[model samples]
Target: MQKLKSKANAKANANVKNSAITTNKRLYTERQKSHFLVHSVACLGTEVHLAACPLEFNKGNSSTGACEDGMPAVVSCVAGPLYTHNVALKKKLKVSKNVRLKGGTHTAEGRVEVMRGGKWGTVCDDRWNLQSASVVCRELGFGSAKEALTGARMGQGVGPIHMNEVQCTGQERSIWSCHYKNITEEDCMHTEDASVRCNTPYMGYEKTVRIGGGRSRYEGRVEVLQALPNGTQRWGLLCGDGWSTKEAMVVCRQLGLGYANHGLKETWYWDSSNVTDMVWSGVKCTGSEMSLTQCQRHKVFNCQKAVARFSAGVICSETASDLVLNATLVQQSVYIEDRPLHMLYCAAEEDCLSKTAAQANWPYGHRRLLRFSSQIHNVGRADFRPKLGRHSWVWHACHGHYHSMDIFTHYDILSVNGTKMAEGHKASFCLEDSECQEGISKRYECANFGEQGITVGCWDLYRHDIDCQWIDITDVKPGNYILQVVINPNQEVSEMDYTNNAMKCSCKYDGHRIWVHNCHIGDAFSDEVERKFEKYPGQFNNQIMN
Candidate 1:
């Protein structure tokens, strides 16, 4: 057994030595000329002579007369992996995660950053070119760099400038792996931050799919160009029955947008184009398809309610916003208020009140308002901007600010079994910074016509006492109920996660006093916990007050 083990170890050592020798030979051969000529000599009938072979001749040299006695014909051959080029295996280059891009609209474009000493720092744009930029793009899961931007086109970066004069072969896995000079403080500034825009695969559907008759490029009625039997292309509408975010994802991807925010069905306001013919229907997608054509579609067109008004629409975004509710604020700020009918005229006109409020006698009824402070935080990489353009924003004289979107939040009172009894919706929320992280500043505001949006790292606060912030639960009988508040409810805007957009609380309303408890983020709990929370009987008896 000892002899066998010794023999195996010796074999392993020999193999290792052979590998090293082969590698050294390969390196040496790679330094030589790429091509050479081969010459051969043979003895024919006792007469030694040079055989004819492909060779480069010197000036005025005769091939036959060049051969002399005692003079040998020299032959040179190319070496290295090229000698066995047909069977040579390509070795994979090592990849590292020390390089990154930041603060661009998409992952494909950003300011380059390198990790060192457990901290990330910027790369100087000095001597930066496409080759070096491509290395960074490839490291970040993209194709080659389409543009290597200088002078901090992605905005000035913060931190130590770590690299300068970077030289890459466009084959490196990380930007730090390339040859670069160690940058000094005086050598670079934040204004010199290097940035890159990477090339991505063309899905070839951009011309075939488009959004028309909308305020912004991101928001519009979806129109697709279909080829006719005679090889002519015509634009037409798509049926909206099974159209959803999954299908919209493909449409956005085809249009070079990052993702789908909302797949709208009834784009009545965007029907100015008047293309009323439905060309496609029953489109279904898994959300990972590269284009809409790759998704499943019905072979035969069958539209139940086919019309231009009911056609599909989409809102695409480069980076989706993540709207997270402040559960603690909702629990602590729960209150009830009595608002007279005359005070809710604006809310009624905007359809913010519940359906039952429409039947109330003029100026004679009061609404039982269950109001709570809603603090929505934009915890995404991008800011949450409204789908509408500035020109389309309605300036509400009552609220004293231009409303970007028509509806933003949904407040609903539900039964213990999940049936909605009464609901209220907040329209045209003027997005502004309520608070921010320690280093971040407020970037948006509602005053003086400032740009309105929930900036990244900022929160928009809606106080409990605000108008139309309460669910009109006057017609709802006193019983065990669930209070649900959903931000971006209709998915009119794109978000990182729709599951976390809802907040739920257990409630017991006894016609006069209301108790709200167990308030939590809808998606924060596990499936088992959610089941338990949904089925748990409240403290109030299961009796409906007439």
Candidate 2:
């Protein structure tokens, strides 16, 4: 029984030792290896090879990794110094002539044979970025070389070698293994083959000159300087004055900068000799409306700041495109014509002007037909009294006499409580005063007992009492106001004191329509015209008064 137990212990010890050995082999085994070689540089090992395969696509679970179902594996060569497994593999890859492979076949007309198919077969060369090929050689257990080969099917099948443009990522098995079409050729030009390593971040140290300046005319090339993220570009140039309708030649180098936002980019352009390369690089602006050829980088910025030129300034915003010349005034020569006097009285015309100006042109004056008939020659430095009709209350005053009086009979007084009527042996005198100033005029007494002392108050009124409506008093601001009233035909009377009373004191009924002789007395002819325009009432329309 002791011997049996000893045998079981010995067996357990052996099994344990064997398990340890198996685990050590699995963990310490070297990872898959890859080789890469440039003309002179070469590196090999798990780190170099495994990393060559885009882990994103090639993993242990991948069919290519397991070599299952005959699925092809992707070979990427991100960095240059690319190479392939066997010389036979070289024939299995397609290449872009623009991108010289370290040791590979030359591409003729952009098509190369890769692979050993009996008849030439076409390989798709899409999505073949150069960086990818660098990885491909690294993954294929090949030393790093310069470029990658990508003609699938060994580049030896019949029919057209479709040869879609090869944008081979060197990491790919072959250039012909790409999947896109219409691939652009990276010509060995400075603009086409721009080295990303040299593109410095913009720090605003370069002198930014707008293509155009104060001058409106243009006659050269306009180009962009910086490359923007959104393909929108800005350009600058030099132009001269009067370039309103002229055409400017603006060159757009569409290499790095492709399609960008529709309206997000503000581009400034002009014509100048300094701009040689027309590539739209870092020529992005904010608020520029003009297109490349049509845009003028510089213009008169502030219209009011005469001759202020627009210079190198970043476009502020889209709204800033339309530069405003705030409050710019053009001084037009005022040709004061010595107009002759016509038959219309200056006072009478002023009334019409006042009424028309009240609504249509209160702040400004309205001129309809101002044809002066009298051609009064300008007697140089001459002093002459203006006609009595032309004199407003500011100039005219008459002393009452024995038979007549200085009276305002038909005068349209906005208010008479402030006016003084002095009686004399001949007539009564109406003092010029406003409603607020009426009490002071009492010192001038009635000169004659026969002259009646009449006082009346005038206020703006609507045509019908029912027409009166209540509006928010807050809505009514304090300002000049006009009132219109229509007197009933049956309630009108008339008098003939033409000159003394230009406005009608009483309404006269001619027919069915009441003849409102001169009810519409304008504020222009009155001394208290400004005072009468105190609080702004509202709008009113009347047949008798305006």
Candidate 3:
């Protein structure tokens, strides 16, 4: 028994030594090149960018190579654990590229969705073939397409249906360059959208990363298997110092999760996992990276709060809600109403009308109000909830309603040159589920302080008769104008996409009557098609205005 125990101990020591050698080799290998290039200079103390660094690449001053090859003459300000906190507070995150694949259990396969003209939409499967599918897969960094599916095999997508009848020859680098047939209303539908399964290389990223303790598979405390200097592996906790949506995005992509819904800085509730070792800290992602290993990290564990309760965490989801205003209703609801000042005490108190309304006689002079109805539709896979909780809600005594958000929508009238002619009044909403689709029960109600949110397949209708729902246009001279209404314009809430939130209409208003036409969502048409909009026969000389 003593001889057997001695042999087992020797084998374990050998395994640790082998792993240590591999780690040393990785310091100078191509793996390190992927994370960073040994530039002559990195971050400077006061300078936010490396370009402003005093070091130059010219001549004998610099020796550039891997970490083990040579030491840099100028030390990077972000080099060691001492400066990780500074970088966390100073490093600016890059804007996220607006693209995602949805309805799949894994990241490498899904119904292809693209963001063009500010909205997320699916590709039509009309001519969907392997050639086109391969381009999409290659663009996502997966090698190629294993299978190209048609007729919404992965499930249908919401918002505008895009990229119909794609024609590719299999060598194109990106799906954007491929030829596609322009879709018509009767030609295609979301039910006939395209989906693909990509030929992804088995990376085995799941072996190193895991969600520590959570109720669901999609959410938990983030823990990673870290290698010790002696080359043994143990599950370690992540510091919550700078974790955010961008870092969560990389984690989700690495785990084959669909998308990141939230990034939790402190996860005390999910601390059920007994991991107390803080092995990673100051993970700064550029919002475009596909994995956490690709991001910048501290050389040592440098956490301000090393408690396990302060570990980084993430909540992921397969889908997000997409909101769109009913453009047809907005156009059809256009009419002029001369509202009496005597009956607008609630409106005046709430600051719903124009600023000039305050100077006018209270019971005499009326204001010309441009009335329109806005129906915000949630067409995506998840319900749309307010960013703040019930405690932050403000109650308006005059309207007798609670405003969940300060400004839910933006209504404006712009000229053909994109100049604002008349600014529309902002309406803070109580946000109730006015109605829902078949088999979908309402989750929010305005009565008795019910929960506030716009459930999926439901809409919150702001009728024309409601207070603070009209535009004060008494001083405006009517001509050719663009009516633009943007839902969630301030982006106070999270959603699947924000580009399709804007709806535009062409309005021709004379002295007596008004005409609103050509209304459509912002992403409804091509740029070329939209450029030809609201163009009167000879409007450059103001013939229509006269």
Candidate 4:
């Protein structure tokens, strides 16, 4: 087995050594049995070919006379593109308009939405067919239609129904070029939104991109291999002028990383990689692109922060906590309570009640509270922990616990048009592994100054009986509203996914009683099933989209 492994490694090493010899891709050379020692003064000092450099090795007892920077000595010529592993790279994608994919886990699949009258709208599944879907696939530069999905298979789209009953011979340049019906309100609904899965050619784009100068593979400065018209290539940097989450999302996705924990604009701290030049600038993405090259960028590299230190960087993660609320728990444990203000002194000190409670005839009158149980589950690949350390946690005498974050979760009531009616925030004083999966021991507990975090496959539940677990609905009018519970609302903590963080339920309150229904996490139901999500779309949120 050892001999076989050694043979395998030797073969791999030969490929790398040959790559170095046939191309001027790498300069930091170390002696390997498979590598030929080479000396190049002109290639190292002056910007010239290796052939122009001296081909002699100085006679020396010490190792430092002929070879500088520990480079081995030989006589040979090497030339080619940067890091060309005898493979060809695909061309960069051009920005597309009129039609684009959205809400897909990756770029190749998404609901078949179209543009009309300067507004985006969905295509109905009345006659959704693969032939028509193939037209969209070709229009977007992909190979062909893998599948035609209907019944809002991608997810519910919010907009006008644009087209229906589409017919295509599959040779059209665009889906719009195919025979399709213009949408009308009476003809279709979002529930019948059409979607498509496309066959995308393997571009090996990830091989041409990398993160450099980090402590681990999970982070560093952004670098991309750029090819020239002459066929030569070089590793280049990305201009950091407006780089952030959306751009980082595409990058992490392209790199096969889970998600972006932090997208940094400047990477002076990780200034180690020798790659140079700001090859791309003004890069924009909708968070659905499968690769960074698929995102939009300036026609020419135009960046004020052209220096290397100001280049884009990213901290990615293969595993992160995904916080999801138990919508069913919220619905089952919701109720209205009228408690006298005198019994709420501790709650008042913690600012659990709304401002109206402050002006209420304290000790004499009662305030109405809408309470519910919130069971937040860490249904991701990593543990759910606060951003700050315990040393920074704030202690509250009223709650007898240390608050890991000032605001960890939010409870809100919204009107029909999405206007905030009433709201309350949870000061997470005790984020612990309330319960864990089978065979997993608890790692975090709030009692006796224990650590704080929700273990993966575990859940941290806030019962309705807990303090500050209720929304002060004292001034809320008796009517229909949406009750939304968002954990990690401010994004103070990183997660595998955030779309599932906000759990909402429809509520109808009639002065005396309240009913909560249709409670679910975003994308959990379909006219709502889904696979991808972000805070904003077609706009910027710590990332440039336009």
Candidate 5:
């Protein structure tokens, strides 16, 4: 009897193990993979990429299955979601108009209303623009219209149209009459049925409006919290706090997140371990717009599993602000005259407009005053020398300027790399500006031939034909050679492109050192050769003189 009981017990144990293993597999697998069921309006060329069988939302595949057309699905495969949820969803829309109005005229306020029972009703011209028109046309699913008519809606009750002046600068129009001025003979535009016909060439971005609201939290322990406009509080870990603006910042030097205040834009540090198996739960802000946190939450077991899978957790929370960064500033003024040099937030004692002296014609040099309005945030570093290019320094300067100024911060030749190279020498260079005092890292770029084939401005480190070429310095004895590195970034490279693919050159020697004149590298150019990889794009050329 004891022997028999032992055998039964072993069989039961095996069954339990099998059940546990199967349950674990299900928990880690993507729950909603490969389930497409969209049936709203779709036009030609509207792409529908399929997801692989084992694929799932956020998680990869559970089981492989043949498509209706009989094809195998695989992981990381180009096919889209294997299963789709809420495919029946559609988008809401609105109408807009771009009628030309006289600059100073109040009657040209771009707007119109519908006429109900001969009574004209005006719309509250809110968030009006071409994009709004695009949505309306897409929703209607008609070929999208060229223009969203305003002001010409069926005339609303003839008296003073409350906000009648529909101000618009018909972007592509040539005629003054193209946009409805206070009074234009163009009768085709009636002031009643403010209509938007669907005349779009194709359908894309139709889902922009359909996106609901919510907040997204990063994977980390909540260290600080701030009350957002709505009832919910915005939370963040030991990194920072407040809405996208400069609310607050936290740092634990031990975690490699050192203390820095000015440029909170690039700072990111999180502890992924604290994240529970949570689906993106959307939190409701005052506006109807849904933030990342506003999304629905995940199941309990799934959340725990997710947290466990990532030993070092990383969480991302949503913010309302979309930040603009690393913008290039070019100097528009050519002549250098004495003028008021100003910075943002400068104390009155330091807030004086720079004045320039008059030319030879004046009895005495007349002073021209330039008022300094605010203190400039120069938060970047400059690179003096780099290898792989003719010896030169690449200087880069960056900072956040005041919002109101139409003015821009540009590169002023503090001093050129005047290694005394004659006009038109074939050499590549790199340069940068820095914010070491502000705790920000180094930022610079190389100069080489660019897309248009000019050997001008910063050249990406790759593509030798356009990058730094080692100079033949044997014959040209080295003394204190004066060289100049100029920087002008090509607008073509985007932020992502710079981070992922741009090239950079670094060197061996740094700071000030002395050497005898004519002491140079044999097969070399500049005796100093330092090398470092740069992952950011810059606004100028990279050149160095050893």
Candidate 6:
């Protein structure tokens, strides 16, 4: 009986030991799966769903179902201490056009409006001051707030009072990042809407550069304030020689204007200021320099033409447009077309036909047209809107769209050496969405007086079959040549990168048929590729033909 009891006790102990082993394995598996989920959630931030994290059961078990149990596996996650901060780092706050200033004459001044939940609202002036206002100005890409006006000095804003008692260190990227009190019923009203006048470079550094004796603020004689060796400041004219867009850009930048459209060498009509002492001469700039003092200059006490009429001038713009061509599309879309001369009236009017057509023998002959499609894109952050207001857009009865700009894109057939042989261009292109990527919708259309512009992430396509989409190559001899397309040729708008605005293609035309190859973005390729592209195999022509 004693031996039987010992065996019974030993059997009982063995059974308990087996159960303990199974429980321990299951616990180990659960712990591993939980750890994996937590790691995935931490890496991917709040966008990850806990259940979606990858896991495996019985992964290291010898048998397929060794870790299987009647109970289901469960995991509970407690966000780690670093989880909140990690999530914030993973997500970026989008800066929208929700915050805007209104009621001021210029874009840099106005009453403040904060867009909240799809509704525009106002900010109370309770604690609105220069620091808080500076945050708004900087967010809009301007300098800082010059004056924080109270009592709706610019004008009253409507809608909900979104914030009050706002505070800022004047360095926040957006107003939403600044601390502010949520609006309450007793907090404020539209009459207390905050207003601000941003501190533009024009107002702060007026002594540095100034425009005078022109019809508008945009056009004027350029004058610089020079500090004499004796510490006295004197305003004088800039010598017109070597004055070009590069020097004008520095002046516009110093004045807070967007860009320089034209740098006038002789502002005879704008010489109303009559301050004829030429102090700055041979002013040369690389277009990226910040101010006139930073540019290379020759100080001169006298000039041969020391008259205010010969002073340099600039036409400043609030913004400049950028146009870029799709070289890939141009390469694949080349063809030859012959249209009747009578049907080329509009093309002739716009100078899209060859120079021979402009002679007295004009519409009597048909010309061989080198036709191709053009895909113009505006990759700048801002929309490439027309410089003129709606009133100035010309009505084009042929294209059934209003022409906003007189010169938009230039098409030129050049010699291998750069001499222009044949030229054609599109005037007043109707900006619209030819196509867009996923999640982007077309904003501008040419129909029914619709707003015209290439919105961000949109493109404008001029098909090869469209009228005037050709270079009149009828009189050209067959040879190797270069095809160049320039957008925004007049620099009517501002762009982040003007270097990428042109595209080129290598062409071999035998009079009857043309072969276009080796097309590329103007500034996209490396130096090695460019050298290889311009290289000739057997013979090289040093002479340029036009």
**Position 479, candidate 1: lDDT:** 87
Better of 4 and 5 by lDDT: 4
lDDT of 6 at 203: 34
lDDT of 1 by residue, 1-546 (tens): 999999999999999999999986876666443332332334332111233223443334333443322233334532222112344331232234567666554446777877665446788899988778877866665666788999876644544677898988665657767899997888898768898998765436577888988888987888888899999989988998878776787788778776787787788887469677889999888665556777887898888889888889987777766678887788799888888888888778777777788888979878888888888888665788887777889977765667788789888888878898998888755788989866889998878887788877789999988887778878889888888988887666766556667988888888998888777667544455566667763652222100
Candidate 2 backbone clash number: 97
- What is the per-residue lDDT of model 4 for residues 1-546, given as tens digits with 9 covering 90 to 100? 999999999999999989977665433233422232444344432211245457654555454544545444444522122212344432233324567665444566777767764446778999887778877876776656788888766555644677889988765667787888887888887668888887765657689799989998989999988899999998899999888776787788788776677777889988566786789899888666667777889998799979999999988876566677877789899999998888899899988888888888878998899999988877555777887789998888866889899899999988766788888889888999888767788899988888899986678889998888999999998887778889887666766555667876768888889988766665443321111112111111211101
Local accuracy by lDDT, each model: 0.74, 0.24, 0.73, 0.74, 0.24, 0.71
Candidate 3 runs further than 4 Å off: 1-132, 135-142, 146-192, 197-257, 263-314, 417-419, 425-430, 437-441, 531-546
Point out the higher-scoring one by TM-score: 3 or 6. 3
State the lDDT at 176 in candidate 1: 69
**Candidate 4 TM-score over all chains jointly:** 0.55
For each candidate in turn, give its C-alpha RMSD to the true structure in angstroms. 16.6, 38.8, 16.2, 19.2, 24.1, 25.0
Regarding lDDT, does 2 or 3 come out ahead? 3
* Residue 400 alpha-carbon offset, candidate 4, angstroms: 3.4
Per-residue C-alpha lDDT of model 6 across residues 398-440, encoded as one tens digit per residue: 6566778898888888886678889888876577888875677
lDDT of 5 at 106: 15
The per-residue C-alpha lDDT of model 2 at residue 24 equals: 58
Q: Tell me the tens digit of each residue's lDDT in model 3 across 457-496.
A: 7889999988878777777786888888898876555455
List, residue by residue over 1-546, the lDDT tens digit for candidate 5.
999999999999999999999975765464334442321222232211122122323222322332323222224411111111233422122212222121000111222333222223333232334434333333333322345554332111112222223333323222122232232323222223233433422222122111011122322332323345688854332222211211111111112121111112122243233323223211212211112222232332232222322211222221111001111111111111232213211211221111111112333332221111111121111122221232222222222111111111111111123222221111222223222223344344222321111111112221212211111121232223322112212211111011111111221111222121111111112112211111111212133211
What TM-score do all the candidates reach, one by one? 0.52, 0.15, 0.57, 0.55, 0.19, 0.51
